[model samples]
Target chain A: MQDNYQQKILGIIGGGQLGRMVIQSAINYNIDIHILDPDENAPCRHICHDFSHGKLTDYDTVYAFGKGCDVITIEIENVNTEALEQLAKEGKKVFPQPEIIRLIQDKREQKQFYKENNIPTADFILTDSKADVLANADFLPAVNKLGKEGYDGRGVQVLKSEEDLDKAFEAPGLLEKLIDFDKEIAVIVSRNEHGELVAFPPVECAFHPTANLVEFLFAPAQISDEIGEEAIKVAKDVIIKLDMIGILAVEMFVTKSGEILVNEIAPRPHNSGHHTIEANFTSQFEQHLRAVMGMPLGNTGLRMPAAMVNLLGEDGFTGDAVVEGMDEAMKEKGIFIHLYGKKITKPFRKMGHVTILEENVEALKAKALKVKDSIKIKA
Target chain B: MQDNYQQKILGIIGGGQLGRMVIQSAINYNIDIHILDPDENAPCRHICHDFSHGKLTDYDTVYAFGKGCDVITIEIENVNTEALEQLAKEGKKVFPQPEIIRLIQDKREQKQFYKENNIPTADFILTDSKADVLANADFLPAVNKLGKEGYDGRGVQVLKSEEDLDKAFEAPGLLEKLIDFDKEIAVIVSRNEHGELVAFPPVECAFHPTANLVEFLFAPAQISDEIGEEAIKVAKDVIIKLDMIGILAVEMFVTKSGEILVNEIAPRPHNSGHHTIEANFTSQFEQHLRAVMGMPLGNTGLRMPAAMVNLLGEDGFTGDAVVEGMDEAMKEKGIFIHLYGKKITKPFRKMGHVTILEENVEALKAKALKVKDSIKIKA
Candidate 1:
């Protein structure tokens, strides 16, 4: 509970856009941040107090890195849990705890964690391989997900028929019954070690039809206030059960029957809450740092209705990046664009995001699409 | 005016707190920032794309730094104007334009500019030295100001009597008739090359009795709507006459007779607008970059009623710095403290600031004083 990390060096395990954003907020409070990632060209290399290029999964590298820091957190969940556990034992604060991260790293274990905690999640069957999933066809028209190392809509596929099952990869996976949902929503919850919990407004996420990636997100979702409250309550329940000391983003599904089901959870600043940087009283990145640093959690009130669209690299671009139409996109008022400092533009890779804030929901929604259409990330 | 500075290098002279805050906003737009300052330990040294430890007033050093950047801006106005003028001739964009900086760099010329432009400022006479002012005696009970190289309440004195004149330093100065003012207010006006202008609400500023520096500021100045509107109009007129790109903060005095008079102006983000970071829709730091980058100006609406208190270094402490009562101060909701990354804290040095936001003005005023009482910046 002591403010040991105040103005001290805090190490982060991953140096992607999330880490980049956390550094952005940390600098405001004069907190020194060091980032560790496998790539030397990691997006966060520029802003952090120090950056070490080493595999986060390498036990020696993570353990050695943790030894020199007062606190350690992650932007990614694939870090060496054994090293984090060791660091925790050595009096280094590891946020979201290594055990929680260990559980969430694997799709099967994460689903089990939900069931064990009595959390509402979709009915899912854990399988060793595609053959096992094909043999048990009861969960047909389900979503097949990899057990580990999958992110950003990767390592997941919808199995609509036997032909879909045949397209499944030969790896351990989880077969989740795709619920008929009215909407996909997300709520970002921040909690400190003091048990203080704050939840951002529920956001409705619309995914691309084929890519299964969030196309755009709207805060204070178009759903009724009652549904938004229900979604938030569900998310808070999950965070309370997990008892994670950091930001926990709960992605949920609102069924036609009005039941809220947890789709998944990310124990760090999630894409759904990106709009918070511009639309909320306190940004999710700042909230995450506050939680892990044992500082008071800030107000999560929305300042205005905001719509966010992700800028993924165009299908063909694969080298040096060029963001076209940025000048035109920025001409609109209340529009903020954040480009992650990534040099290359690989197809479908997250290059940046644009947030549109407006008092009128319809107007903001229209502006969001126009922004999405105007900008293209290419090589 | 194209957005040529997008994802391009921006060279800023003087890497102090103002430059640091500007860099914080610049990072969001993916613009590369490089800073030139004499202090390698300056607040912006770490955050910028590149930092050159060199004399800002040296023509060769500044010209070299300008050559590598797409556009050059300034946090302090004392940089070599000749270097900037040369860069401008070579086709590099320099905000606030070196010609304007030349005129504002001297108090005598600045007052002359106000008179020439038909700006409503205090009546003043340019003096070659303090001896000239004493010999004339016409502007007794006036304010004596140095022509150049003065900042942060330095190089200015009140000459109330013959005894007060003896305390003045011998230098080329300006003698202005001191007017009895009801309140001191400032408005930050941002304008781009496209002539798009936006003005923040007038903020009332209170100066420290001894330091003569802003101690606290209130946004939307506790005045009637008419007075606030008149103050903003005056500020806009000054900015229009200056015709400078980037932000110009116009300081004004609301006299006892209800007439507003321009006090002075800073061609950069001024301290009185620090509360905008937490209380407004878009921060002044971000607005400055928008103007300099040729992007559309953002909304300048206030998000909440807010009060800001400056954090000057304790009167005695003069070594490495420490901010006491941060935990206690941060415990109060809506109280945001920003500490400049200053290793040493000398007496009356601008160390940082705290912003208190509340819907109720009375409650916020009370909370602001409590925050001011709680935190202490010491060495």
Candidate 2:
């Protein structure tokens, strides 16, 4: 039988909303896909051409799932790297290859790699003993953060006073001074295997204040061109140093002097680039898969000035997540809502996001604020 | 079992590319779906959560497949209306409802309904016997079209000269004069169950001169405001008259005398509205689902000026299909490519389309022509 569709399958290791969205890109190219995830009802299952319901990290599941595809990719980072490495050794394409995945899986290795590569980062003392920094009275109270899997403010603590120092006893990790900055920002940069790289405009990050998850991202950065160039340069240099072959979203801190410092990196599509779906010519998820597959990247031009507001589960809400006022909220011009289709949600869990695209910055900001207030993810 | 993630299961009767595209919108809301089509590997099969492979016209299949859905709809016009009516009688929610489906299923009934409701359409005479038309002689050299299931230049014929008239001596249907059309345009007007209606920017269409199917659609239709308003009024009137609670694509022809006349109407997403995916604030497919499901209608504002060029298979190709130069065509700024995942090729088969978005009409038109010439669909 002759197979007519020319695009090869892009196998994704996790079938969450990220994978679901990645499949959206694959659909445009008529690319066949095989998805692996634990849930039979995983969001990605809806669109994946072929799906295997199993743990993403199960070595057999990951390896076998990869064998049939021309390239293997991932939506989440928790997949087992050893299994991926074995597959890569057998000539299956795994991007953000197992080699790179290995370097970024552990926070200790990730931070140390940055240090070894002479990348500018906050200086921290890494130790196996959590008591070392606190017991050393000479050591001023500093921030103690776990070197691995620190997500959504979990495993990270701000230690300012003497009394708060006891909290550091729980996480046996590194201690560094918390950088005082004006605003948080992130840049979604794409680098193909051949070294072609392009960066979307930096997005100004606004945290939830309480939840610590990025609540909103304002596009076009609203910063001077000089600062924008500096940010993109920093992101480009990070990609070059990491030898990244796909999209690497570089999150950073902007100092009072408008200097950008590297904060973290995500090998796949990042939440910060969500605005690109409706605001930019090419979405980050599409760019990541294209770059990894050695396919030509799309235009990253801005389609409109936009802002993205994440929808987290409201506190005390758990089952059968409901996006209230969504119908009413979406009536506003330029507002685009994306519900993740997750059934259950713990408090602060990412439920969805709403993007507003318009030309008038002030007017769009006003509407975005209204949309943020009107729409709620609750049971 | 209390279904946590379940919102509503929408069953679509046809599994063609339009149904495949509709699945995309339902995916956005994480809506469960059951698509019934005969092909085992139908393009819409995997994208839909639960798809039962069956023929739409089969009574048992149509009736059973729609039992579990909250509301049932269709992308194709040809289906068993009796089965749908039976389901509706049993309290199943079917949009374009059963009555509307029954009336539109046959050409004779459709023409009668249009005339009774004063809907402007081409003058026609419906006669099954070719002898009746020949005996009349006045209907000779007429535009003879099928009363059912005609699409994309198929099931339609134009009797131009005496040679054509003689061949029509054994034709199956009656005919009428071919009205010289000025400019063809389409209005994607959506109406919810609540009677709320919103019209997308009218799209001006140009035919292939040979294929008869729309070759391109220039959105933000470069016509006078009066003509645009008239198109919207016609579309809205059709929606109201049909009492169709979903999207309706009203195709019209502006005569050489500037008089607008209805050409045809599709009660579901139409090819002429494909440009809305990237150009409009709300895509027609999503809006269709929303409207039929009784959800609040969304904004239909144009995000940018867009032009869509269809991808039709060349006449000589007939095996496995391939589209060349896609990589280079979509690489240009403001160009968005959509592939229908069609494998087989025949003369004038609808393959896919490319939408170019730019504020400058001249620039967009130039890009559209280049896109049309650059990409070739062949077997």
Candidate 3:
């Protein structure tokens, strides 16, 4: 246990908005936070106590950064797991463990783990070679995911016919039949090393079709209690199976037939839970720090209904980012805007987010739409 | 108006908890915050864009700190107002303008302004010398306030008769007839440059008699709606009369007969409204930044009932501060703790605070007591 607050230094792997917010909470506790990100202008630089500009996937970089920290955690999954494994072997506290990251990093391994653990996820076939999937005709009209390095929409393709099968390459991957789903939801759960677990209320997330990025999120999703409970149960089950020790965000699909299928998991604070910062009793960022630091998990209760709108970079403008129509959006009540300190803007890059809270979810959604339309991220 | 976020650098005069929290909110807006305080380890140091260690009371120090900033503000009112006056004269946007700070720095002037503006405050008589107070013996059994440098309890004394009047010193001061008050309450009010005003719900504070420090504070002030409304009205009246920008925390006393009297006011984020950080849609710190930056104020609506317990340094333990029984307090649900990064623990120093939320105000109060009993701040 940490004897002095000054000695409680936490090392974070990524330096994006997640890391930035974690540092925000860490400061409240007087915890020293250090970040390792290749970008010198990472969003977290100004807030963190220390910054080491190095590739998160570089073994030496990750190991050196973790050496002086009391506990090591990640804000992103694509990190040097081997270095984390080495650190854990030396008795350093690495939350979610290097092994868990290895499982979640690969779509094939993640799906196999869910099946082996009897967790309800989408049915999929993992193949060692992509040629097997292309030659076999059974996996038509499927979603093809590269085994590794499959970020947002970059490595996932929808293959509807034999002609579209050419998208597959000679790499290990997974093929899953697409299911008609009514909605997408996520449950952000956290567990400490002592096994105390807590989950925020499930939030429904809407994604942009072309960008494959979350456009908006609504807390306490406008769904039946039964569906919300089922989604939370799936999320809790996944955490327990993986023995996750920090924040585990579980995204799942609610099928038209009332079944919940686990989609993916992020072993850190996720975008879907951003509304908690304004509308919940405990923010996910604060909770994540509590869990990783071996402190008691905070109460996860919604204080009000809330919706989150993403601020994505405009398509035609790229250079230094500028947020337009902020004053106009500020005129609306219950609207809170956050602009990530990113110097450059590219098409579809996440610049910031806006959270709107109201007693009625519908009214909140309406106000959220208005905010989304008024604010534009450009350069 | 600032066309780009990067150019919106905000300079804060005090680097204490209020300044630290303002930076916490300022980061979300991507605004650069620079703080000036004599202590290099000031709480705002780690998170701010820039830090200059210098006495806030020194005119040259404050002026030099404000020279490169677009706007200047304060977390504490003890700074050099002349520097702020010069900054304002040179086209810098100084919130709660230096003229207002000058008026608030002295009790005699503050009360006179209240009288001139028809604001409701305890009746008082301004005196230039200590002998005048003694000459008018009918002002017996009154409260004597030192005109300047009078902190929470240090410079105030109650005299019952001429025998006890010797405590009065030769300085500009005020003597006010003491009233039998039922409770102490405060309302945190905010105003933008455009005259738009917003107020958080009134909060009741319980004080430590010997220390003259707040022990705990309850939001929505467990008072009749009529009394609550009166408190808010007086607060709003004071804010408008001061022509205040940023946040104005009005502390008032409610007499046994249900009459309200403004006691004192602070022109910045205050301890009384700290509960709003967790229980209201907009925190006082965030609201202060928004108002000062010319943004529309956020929704000042309650999300839940909350109580705040102050964590003061334990008596006779004056080394590095150590918080004891934190784990025990964390066992209670809805209890949030904050520790200011003060390296040393002096007796009765304001180290940090804890916020408790519950549907039942009485239950919350009960839990608050338990938490208070369980936690100890020592060296």
Instruction: Pull out the clashing pairs in model 2.
Output: A107-A147
lDDT (C-alpha) at residue A356 in model 2: 89
- Residue A191 deviation, candidate 3, in Å? 1.4
TM-score of each model, paired residue for residue: 0.96, 0.96, 0.96
- Tens-digit lDDT string for candidate 3 (B93-136): 99989999888888889999988998878888887778978876
TM-score of predicted model 2? 0.96
* lDDT score, candidate 3, position A239: 95
**lDDT for each residue of candidate 1 in B276-305, tens digit (9 for 90 to 100):** 887887899989998988877888889789
Off by over 4 Å in 3: A1-6, A127-130, B1-6
Which digits, one per residue and each the tens of the lDDT, describe model 2 over residues B322-358?
Answer: 8787777756788888888877878888888888999
Residue A70 accuracy (lDDT) in model 3: 85
lDDT of each: 0.88, 0.81, 0.87
**What stretches of model 1 exceed 4 Å from their correct place?**
A1-5, A224-227, B1-4, B224-226
TM-score of 3: 0.96
Query: Tens digits of per-residue lDDT for model 3 on A153-271?
Result: 67787777788878775688888878778999999999998889899999999998888889989988878999998888989999998988999999999999889999888999989
* Alpha carbon RMSD to native, model 2: 2.5
Among all candidates shown, the one with the greatest DockQ: 3
Error of 1 at B336 (Å): 2.5
